[model samples]
Target: MGIKSALSRPLAAYVVHRDRQWQREPVAAQLRLLRRLAATGAPTAFGRAHDLGALRTPADLARLVPVRDYEGLKPYFDRTQAGEADVLWPGRPLYLAKTSGTTSGTKYIPITRASIGNHINGARDALLHYVHATGRSRFLDGKLMFLSGSPVLEQHHGLATGRLSGIANHHVPAYLRRNQLPSYAANIIEDWEAKLDRIVEETLPEDLTLISGIPPWVQMYFDKLLQLTGRPIKDIFPNLNLFVYGGVNFAPYRAKLFESIGRPIDSIELFPASEGFLAFQDEPGNPGLLLLLNSGIFFEFVPAERFFEANPPRLTIADVELDRQYAVVLTSNAGLWGYSLGDTVRFVGLAPPRVVVTGRLKHFLSAFGEHVIGEEVEGALREAMTQFPAVEVVELTVAPRVSADPGQPSRHEWLVEFARPPADAAAFAGALDGALRRRNTYYDDLRRGNILVPLLLTPLPAGAFQRHMKRLGKLGGQNKVPRLSNDRALAEGLVENP
Candidate 1:
């Protein structure tokens, strides 16, 4: 074994042991974290406004600080961007993580010195856990590439500002820098296509063992590599084994990815966002991601069904129940107070508190009162893929298709880009519809009442989704197409262009 791999084994064991000790007492750890965040925020402008000094418990925080999304907290963010210190957190923020906003034009989330470790070490610990679990530290000696945004930072009021991934690029530990791929120049290339080509060239000859990125982008890299070399990914880089991914459900892309690689390999899932590194898969074959209890972020969950109520109950980790969907709220050391993260999640295991991200709060389709969430759609697709093993989906999105004609019934329209189209398309659609109905009672009711017809499947040529994203100037770098929309905006665009 190489020196780095040999050394990593002991470190991995130590980290795993330390991690499990805290995981054993999740509720206590979370309560302690909440108190720390409250105390730390007591000196900030927001803290003073919310009377954070008197807060001693989760109930106290919920009473004092209202849950707010980006627009609701824009005033404080504006102050921070204009060089104000201690507006949100104590003193000045070390960096600003720039991210795309839907209603707001651009969002700059603060990354304080105390909070940045949550982002960096969360990823490090994920790999360390894998090493400890499987004794597979040899991958450390090979090229490890993180498909991410440019590391180039643009200064905003003297604070280094860039995409979260770009900000993370600066914090990659020195030990693994030697094994990192795509060179500095390649990573800095502005255009994604150009950068991808450069990455392909730079790593083509290297001993690539692990790759980490959002699933779709990583699939793009795999496809490009195959196009250039005409070899299965396993043959191109024999050492390549682990694929670490986040941002979207991997079920839709799993079949295609493994097909490209020409073999099944291990993968690790992470639930990370600009706001915080929330969770990571701690065990092989376990679908749930172990929620980070001591990561300087205190989590709250509001029942998704009651999230829009005037005063929804915000429950702490100790109060949440298994299998119930809840919208995630954050109060972190990064100075975000009761920040609505917009993602919905369900706890699969609560002893140590493991969750699966279900969908975004605003990303569901309820145009016709049949509330179809991202998890349902993705789950439905997985069922169809299972039943129709010949089908290979590249990308897919669902939107409501309302009919103007009184005689015509409304239906959900699925726009799918297929690498391999299903031979029995009708049967495949039936399987998807059946699976969705089984999962969602409202949808099943609508179908039985003839309020909506079976979903319509519209196939698009390969690269259609990629082209559409490029047209919207969201070609790469943390952009994802919504799995379901209440309106026909995304669906119409795809159909018009295709």
Candidate 2:
């Protein structure tokens, strides 16, 4: 075996330091991390309530609170919706980081003092770790454009308003508050059409070298940038580095975005989320996901079988074996005790556990009684896209709907934006159609004969993606584009006309 990665262990140790000393402690010695978080204020109250039940081993947390989903937090949510002071966070409640679920309701996850501390530490830790792993300090090379939720803050307009992008930024650490191109309050709730226009006109820095946010939204930004410059984006920001993104899957758009900028996925990095900055693509050569501050939050792994069942055994950090898909659960300084963020992960190893996010247990297409997951969809899309040479997919989304025809079948539909515009839409559509049917059984039957039509290829306007960013008010900076929509309302609204 190779001796060691030059920068990984030291970077891992730094990440561990952020989690109140628990993150760095060995898996077998994190009881101290638990005790430290529990002794603090605000967290101490809720932590006591969860009891977190003696985390001597991964199996121990199972004895405390079982893995929980948002549906399980109805009481806390109700308290929050009612403006109860003691709803989620026990202290003065530093702030709220609002994230939306697949369905309608907004989840105002409490970001306490510890959570804020961890967020800042992790954000910086990720930077430091990236440098260590790559021996590069491109962090300040170019301004990072974040395509995110609205930056505007509206007071009590409605509960769902909490999911706006601007409100979520409230919890971002003070240190990072300035590097942003525009204040998030400018993105949140407003006339998106106008905000995007101003954002497009004002922000697009000449020195921009890095772009961050979700894939779809960044694609939109590239579209807008092209409209403004009338030249290749690669020509505009010649030094643009990587696209740091999260919130949804990125495989589908990898081809499209790269074709636009004439680059590849290595220029981008995926991230960890609310549960913790769980893992990141550390070293390009390694092709492995690096676990962050492992000692900070104790990790537990339950076989896929136990994810939805009543009594799943929680495997400790030391107990995790490589290459196994597990339902993720965590105990952290953020005051989340034995909380199941409702996501799945795959481990590449045990010690320091290199891992990759697999899929979200909650977000899947169950409308057809067929359980299709994020990974399956990503796999099929990549497999289909591989059919063409020099083709990059800019926009790809899946939806479930019944057509108006008498014998119509339930189907998966996609809208692809390509770098080299296809000469024949019908031929291009047919090739992708044949590939999907062959790759997936349920889908194959859906397209057998007259059931579901082959996948539809929508040719976007020259600056089509930009119109989307302008519409969403994510002209520049860590904003994201919507990846999958079951309903066509939003997609139709986003459709481009040349």
RMSD of every candidate to native, in Å, equals 0.9, 6.1
Candidate 2 per-residue lDDT, tens place, 38-146, comes to 4442344344566543444344556656676666655665565566554344544455556655454666655555555555455555555665556555445345555
Candidate 2 residue 156 C-alpha distance from true site, Å: 6.7
Cα lDDT listed for each candidate: 0.93, 0.58
Candidate 1's displacement at residue 167, Å, is: 0.7
Counting clashing residue pairs in each candidate, in order, gives 0, 36
Report the Cα lDDT for residue 161, model 1: 94
Best by lDDT: 1
lDDT, candidate 1, residue 480?
91
Q: If scored against the real structure, what TM-score would every candidate get? A: 0.99, 0.75
- Model 2 misplaced stretches (Cα beyond 4 Å): 1-26, 29-32, 35-56, 80-90, 102-104, 138-142, 150-179, 183-189, 262-268, 272-276, 285-287, 294-296, 366-370, 400-411, 415-498
Candidate 1 per-residue lDDT, tens place, 1-498, comes to: 999999999999999999888888988998988888888889889989999999998989999999999899999999998988999899889999999887998898999999999999999999999999999989999999999999999998889999999999998999889899879999999888999999999999999999999889999999999999999999999999999999999999999999999999999999999999999999988999999999999999999999999999999988999999999999999999999999999999998899999999999999889889999999999988888899999999999989878688899999999999999888888999999999999999999998899999899988999999998988877889899898888998999997
Q: What is the lDDT of residue 348 in candidate 2?
A: 74
For candidate 1, the lDDT comes to 0.93
